[model samples]
Target: MKVVKRLIGQRCLGIEINARGELMGLQVLVDKKDNVVLGEELTGMNEIQAFLDEHPLTPIALSVSSDEIIYSRTDQQLDDQSMSDLLRQEVPSFDPEDFLICYLDGFYGFARKEAISEHTSALSAYADQVVLLGFGPIPAYNLALTLREETSDRLTVGSYQFDLNDTDVQEITPQDLEVGGLTVAAHQVPAFLVAIGYFQGGLGMMGYPFAKNDENLWYGMLLNKLWKPVLFSILALLMVNSALFLHFNSLNQELNEQSVLMQNLSDRRATLASYIEQNRQIARLGERESAFAIISDQIGATVPAAVTMEQLVLSPQSADRRAESAYQKEKVLLQGITTDLKAFSLWVNRLEGMPWVSRVASQKLTETNGVTRFELALIRHVEES
Candidate 1:
């Protein structure tokens, strides 16, 4: 309610006839811009386009000269029946069809239909969606809602303020509110605020299409004419959303199919890996068996005549490993019991000295009741160089 009651004015486009009664310039008041452009500048539609270029899609209130309109306040707050009777008695010259009549209960505004049509047609050429078309200087009494001798309704233009009503009831002068530049001057702001009370100023308007029949209620500006476009917009939005949903659903299905295919490929890869490991083990065992015979003959030649050996064993160092040769590497194990520790040491040193031996160590070395029981292993050497 405060939004309506505050007497605010937005961008207003004012039109008027010249002194010669020819279609004249347009006065543009945009957002109370203090730098108001006046006569001769808006000679054509150029000014209107220029204003719109700067302030696009701004709501425009049209203010015409007050001489073009007839405004009055009745003695009593008239009902429709009383209003018709009063209008008939007061203004018998007015034909309802020749003129457009717009009124609140007490305040009324009327203009000739032919003249308004001409003004509107010219305005429609220059602008769009003209919301409020009224006489420029609006009545303060209408907004105040009462006529008091002490109270006054005044509208300021360039250097002067005009009286909307003579003594009691008032109407705003329809002088175009002029706003010139992008930056409005501070002193020129007050007049625009006053014009606000008149533009969408809650006064009854003759030509404005979307004004309320009774008051400035929110729904008053929205006529029954607006329903079809709003309905079509909603329907169009729903259709777009449905199309997008179908598209994304198909994409999701494709993604799921690709995911399943990937999982199958991963399982196949694991099976192939296991098969390769089994082949590696079989190849390593073949190499170990083939090398066992050669290693046994070499062990027989290396052993001293003084030592006896048992539990002779030879095996490849890694069964699961792949090798380029049948006799890649092997570990040799031998056991013996000897009374001479010095002779055992000499034999161990000889085993280490062999080029095939990587390392030599005893797995078990035990002496009991003057006899020594021992084990030794010689691992095959592998050098990159």
Candidate 2:
């Protein structure tokens, strides 16, 4: 409640009409703690209005002289709505609506609405709202509560003195007013304390009933206090959401870029694999060609001049009737005509001496015409030979 009062920035402009018919005004701005922001003995309507203009947009608490108000005490418990009904039941001669009613303690004070409007309408132009619109010493009741350290049930200021109660106040004569307890001369009672009471009363610290329309002002002040922080919180949430969205969007874009890079790397790896396979095939073909060249050179160097070579085949297909042509082995087949069989026999023995030739077999030997025709098969060792 104290925080709410501070947030609404509730201030009070307490004006009292003195015995001399001069307008005495005091302005007080309330916070978590009580502070008399401005205190001046304002006289005349122009001075009051100017004083009020100095602190614009503050609630006003006007206190008229006791003579202007009709005071009554109610024995029964009453509410704001029933105050007028109670006044009408008590004073049936006049209309209850014609007066602005204020109930404090057990007493109800009724001031003519026209009389209050005449003085307040002009002053109201300078104030934001009206907190209290009736009674002279009403504000002093709250002032006594505020000054708890000062044990005074009565307050005297200016020419008039008022007896203060827990929820009531009564104007008394100078002789009837008590000794120096909480007395302030020079119209100081209503000047400072009344302004402070306006704040307290409006804040619901004291149960003094104000004008009914001031309820709207109270609600408006509450709304004014609440909406600023709510709006700021909404804006803060929006900023956080926007920041998160931007952060996630940045990460998403980076992920997409990484995916594309990964795909490009994958394609490059596949191309490298294909190149390695082609290089392996080329290496195998080169090895086979080198092996064939070495075997042909060894065969040419071991040949005999007495034997005429007609045909020579390495790793020949088998010619056996039982075996298919698909079967082949590491063997050399030679068909030739030799004029001297003795030279052939000597050449065969030399061929068997070679490391590559395991054995040489003579398959056929026949005298055809004047040349001796022979067919030989040379078997090679298991490996490349």
Candidate 3:
């Protein structure tokens, strides 16, 4: 509260038309601690305007003469239409439109539009805002409440006076109280109290809203009202965005980590596939070696005493081709020297009759001296269906 008061740095120039028909003005300055510092009273409009010119930024509160203002108190709230009807009925001499009405805390104050205009115009040039404080000791009552001062049965302001018989009574003397370290007299209480209340920002409840003269000041008040909430909303949005960014950032990092893990698994899978293929190749070669051994043993056993074996080729490559001899994977080529042709023919027939032999075809036959050089293809036999 102190910091807020300091930031506002409010100064109120309270100009009251006292009961004595004298225009009295007092300027009250409220410190950061809400202490009231009162200025000496100025007697006329000239003096008040001069003081206002010196402090052009201050707000003014005009307390019109009690005779010119109509006030009423109620125990319940009244809407604008109801209040308007009441004001018209009470002051039948003038229309409700001619009066500026203000209601607060069950208290209503009505002032003639002309009277307010005349008072505000005199000081409007020097002040930013002007408020009607209305008639009576209401301002004084609020100030006394703020100071926690004991209430008296009666309170007076200049020639105007009012009785507080309905209020809870306390028998303390008004002289015993000290306001802002200054001793105040009983008669000066009303004016000084009003000024103090205005300075302390306590007059907002009782001030007449229609009395505020400047549009710029109203806009400024609106800005002050909207400022804090807007700032808080912006800050909240920034915090939400920051939190979302962090959450997504973490998710992205986790996804990257998962991708790396998947890549490693894929690489391992490829290596495993390569090893499996190599193992299959080796197993096929082992089966081929076993088949080659079995076939070579059968061929050697079929050889007769007259035939001397020279060379044998199984599944010979294309490079070993002889004239008119085409290579077949299932055929075995045999080359030998045979002294007796009949024995060689019987040997071929014997080999062909074997269960594993498909058929035997004679590829080449040559003779050199008494020895015979021959080439034969021994095709394996197939069983009849």
Candidate 4:
């Protein structure tokens, strides 16, 4: 007999239920020959909510047992109707509505409706996608079918046997045994069966796999497997968009407020610029009026009675609009005749005591006729900028 090679890239999550009904998962890898069970792993069943949170994408295959599975056999060849009637007779407590009956060449299988619903629900909680749903010890029998071809003589797993000569499958007391240099441990049979069952179910050979669903394959798979991922993806995308919209709106409001403030400050600065020159001219006039008053009082207080002024000249330069100057200082020139030089000298010394006089000098001194003639020039103190 020619052996078909296993699809090398094929892999699945093989799962079985414990006595507590908790799931035990194994990662199975397929090679050219038998399917390999790599190791046991922490199942996503208890952590179903977390799986939905983080990894809503991994596929799952489950070998579940929630129903009362009854085995029956018919000696006469049976049609679909007869097989259904025969299965009911074999398990009297079974109802057609609550249970689905499966027949494979006169071998009958029965499982309750509620059991399948519960099993698939539990599987979806762990994975959004259920790649395959298989029931009872069927995957084990699926393995047995493959092993029979490999051994060629007789192959056994626990109490189940895969015989080359016999068409019918049978069960005996399970034990650990070595066949063709391979040791089949009793405890390892369940996991091994699940992996082989998943492997064969994926292969789609002759369709009499351990579990068979003749009618509702498409509806059952779509409702359980693909719905959740599509729904969750949409919701997460909407939340991100909403947050971004709010952040942009806040920045726009702040930008508008700053623009208004900047425009107001620019208008105020333009209005103040027109009055700049007017303010400077008025301020300069006030300072010159105060200085002239101080000078007049000092000259009258220090002048000598013997001196008679022939001429007096005070020249004060005004702020020139063309030069754009803020203010200009004043200078003094006096011409007088004195009967005595002693009086003239005394008068000059007293003028030096005034705050505004920086320097006093006699520009001319001469004896003409009966009186002495003199010319005096004065420099006024100017404030630094």
TM-score of each: 0.38, 0.55, 0.44, 0.39
Which residue runs does candidate 4 get wrong by more than 4 Å? 1-8, 18-22, 31-40, 47-55, 74-97, 101-106, 116-121, 124-128, 152-154, 162-188, 202-385
Best by lDDT: 3
TM-score of candidate 3 on Cα atoms, chains taken together: 0.44
- Model 4, span 21-111: residue lDDT tens: 7666655555545535354454556654454345343345666655455554456656656765666666677456666554433444566
lDDT of 1 by residue, 220-339 (tens): 323233567788888999999999999999999999999999999999999999998798779767866766777677767777755667766775335445654443345678788777
The positional error of residue 67 in candidate 3, measured at the CA in angstroms, is 7.5
TM-score: model 2 vs. ground truth: 0.55
Instruction: Name the best candidate (by TM-score).
Output: 2
Candidate 3 lDDT score relative to the true structure: 0.63
Off-target runs (Cα >4 Å) in candidate 1 are 1-223, 290-293, 313-331, 337-350, 363-372, 383-385
**lDDT scores in order:** 0.54, 0.62, 0.63, 0.58
Q: 1-385, model 3: which lDDT tens digit per residue?
A: 3344456655566777654556777676666566767666677878877776665545667665556666666655566766776666777675666776655434566778677666555555654467446455456545544443444646443333334434332323334236546766554555566566555453433224434543444345445756898999999999999999999999999999999999999999999999997987687568547767887788888799999988887766566567323445567888889999999889888887888777776657798998888898877643221
Residues 86-163, model 2: lDDT tens digits: 766777675655666766545556767666556555565644466665465555544443453566656553343445
Put the candidates in TM-score order, highest first. Answer: 2, 3, 4, 1
- What stretches of model 2 exceed 4 Å from their correct place? 6-10, 17-22, 30-55, 66-68, 74-78, 93-97, 141-185, 202-269, 289-385
